[model samples]
Target chain A: MKRGTLKSRLAPVALLAGLLLALPGAPLRAAELDAEQQARYQTLINELRCLVCQNQTIADSNAPLAADLRQQVETQIRAGRSDAEIKRYLTDRYGDFVLYRPPFKAKTWLLWGGPFVVLLIALGVALRFVRARRAAPAATAVDAAALRQVLADEAGDDARRPPENRS
Target chain B: MRLRYLVPALVLIGLVVLFAVGLRHDPREVPSPLIGKPAPAFSLAVLGAPQQTYTLADLKGRPVLVNFFASWCAACRVEHPFLMQLAAQGVEIVGVDYKDTDADGADWLARHGNPYRTVIADPQGAMGLDWGVYGAPETFVLDTAGTIVYKQIGPLSEAVWRERVAPLLQGAKP
Candidate 1:
């Protein structure tokens, strides 16, 4: 019985090990580049948005299109294309949507400055709230004495009342 | 209402309106910047006809409809008949067989009537990449000057052809 339980437990682990072993090893490295070329290639891919997988950069995406684009970027880099030139080439074909950081233009003004505008508006509101809170105490300070008098009068009335009336 | 509160309320309304408008349109339908710009230059050999080459220069001086297709793409099959109909209507359609095997592309064209004036074999999708074709069945309408005037990202329906493409072709000098 002990042997049976041990075998059952080992079976899953063995299967898991087998599955892990079956998985393809490290990704294939197709290109040999110097450190500078590698760095530039990395930066370019990181900056480029994968059109197929909208959320991921080309470097991070596993989509076939992303792989093709990575190859294209590598080729462009090897061909001594400037980063700007490479970006311009991609933008010309895929439009500005393929860029992670879109250029500042007339149409993109809202996209670029929208957050700051919202932040400023939020700060203005917050400032107004703080000012209102600060000003509120000043207005209530005059009523403090009157409120104390009212409380004292109530206490005196309570003392004068019979036990049954208090009840 | 106080002006202070009114301004925020107005801003909120404006934001809501903007979001509503944004929501109405499909985000995937990004307008191509190539529209109104000159078509990308490419010189590819005609599929199955290695001797004949189709260059962008050949497309100049005449309006052309460039259609990207693949045998593996189901949508391409769906649009094949319409493309044939357009070809029958005297539309000069150029085909880009994207990333497809030569044999399969030839067989596909044979099975489906070849509606293209010349089908360029883009086995590695090099030309398709230059043309910015994300998916198959993308069609572009170029004016006589080889300027891309209109682009349809999906399969071309009769309605789209009659409404959008026909008008553009009519405006172009035959």
Candidate 2:
């Protein structure tokens, strides 16, 4: 009974795994790549963005264009093109947008640095706010003293009143 | 001290304005880098007549408008009449039936009134990749020297043809 239950549970998982593997644009049957080439292939695909499905990497997209691009990448890899050459080839044709991680350059300096610049500005503002708040306690202390004096004067006025008026 | 909060508020408002402006423009209309560069070479079979092959070299030494289209694309159908008009006006238009079956492409051209001087078949879209074509109904205006002068991303309209492409062709002649 235990064995049967386990097999039944494994069946759907195995079927799902098969469906995932059969998805279009998923890497085809493993090519005869050595360890180094395999690593490079993974890196290249992950770095390249799919133009059709802008949100996905070429490796992750199921679009026909992505499949074609993958085939092109594999062909280039087989042709002994270096990783840099392949990246340059795609970028030259498709522009820098095809890269998931765009290169740091003069034009892209703002894209790369804008976040850090904003963060720094925010930090400066927050620091100033904290410092100002810290310094505000002194002013608040003077206000508290005035409040205490008012309370004492109110108490004196109440004490000076007649017992019937107090009642 | 209150002004410190104003800095972030202003930045946020500025970003919101920038995003609003950006939303007005089509994000799919990425400018091609191939403009002002030499057109990519291609040798593809004619759509109906597979025996005859058309090459990019055959149309050299003259301005040619290369259009990429597919039977499956609705925008291509919409642009068909404009292309036919341009062809009638003595414009040499080279058609690339991108990633479409030969029979479907041939049928579409016949039904829509073929506008191309010569039609090439890119069954696998291999040549389309060389030209960095992301979608269908893209048109490129190549100068006499085989340099790509201008590219239009969407379906062609009469206004666009008159405003942008007409001047380029006239400028190319003498």
Candidate 3:
């Protein structure tokens, strides 16, 4: 609900919104921080993975490990450590998996480019469908007026025949 | 018949194969970056004897097993007996009581029987964080050179010890 001070932290709307909805109770440490420092603190915790749960970020998880990680972030912030330094400290120990954003490296080339690859393939398929439809010959139109006249004449001829004569 | 007709089907299969691989991979087991790197240096008081301290340097030049555990963790209980078996066979295991109270940790070990060569109290879990521990029952195998070689994320089973760990310890230059 407190989105005013946390706009920067909530930049990735869908990820943060889902995480915040799942966020249980208040966060672990409401460590005293100024406006700018608090914003920085929120950003770090929100982005860092809670390794215990594996799915939830430290900001959303109720795991004790998440709490400890949050506390660590706050402590580092108070110590005047930069955001990059704090992140590097964690990634150094926990690997790049600890960060929600996987680093754009050789190993993650697929992960980074996968969506666009899928999109391109889909576009190609769509284009092919459109082109195939364009190339296909159209069907000949039916003569509706002639068809109605023929049916009417058939009905009249059938009526003109008497019961014995019709046989 | 044409290659373009098969492209979408091929893409669909590729997606399925990628997802299947992801499914097979265990998310709980985070691949440790510390592997092939020297173990993090730590100096913590030994459980039940705060006066004495154990450090990473003490375990150098020998294959060592550093186990992260807590009385609060259920999985640690599962591996306790197996750990005792390893210790009986002269395996030196260093137990780090991660993020647990002194009373509970000591009591739990006393009840279960101590299997560790040296049980260090990591009350605040600062050492655990330094070791990049997110959960209990994590085990790390250090080579003779003090480089972390293997890390097991959960409770040890007899099979894991017999197959993976025992072989690594043998390969470790004594």
DockQ in order: 0.56, 0.59, 0.63
Q: Tell me, what's the RMSD of every candidate?
A: 5.7, 5.2, 7.6
How close to the true structure is residue A35 of candidate 2, measured as C-alpha lDDT?
A: 76
Docking class of 2: medium
Quote model 3's TM-score for chain B.
Answer: 0.92
On lDDT, the leading prediction is 3
lDDT of 1: 0.86
Q: What is the C-alpha lDDT of each candidate?
A: 0.86, 0.87, 0.88
Evaluation by lDDT, superior candidate among 1 and 3: 3
Model 3 docking tier (incorrect/acceptable/medium/high):
medium
Docking class of 1: medium
| Candidate 3 positional error at A37, Å | 1.5
Model 1 regions lying over 4 Å from their true place:
A1-30, A136-167, B2-16
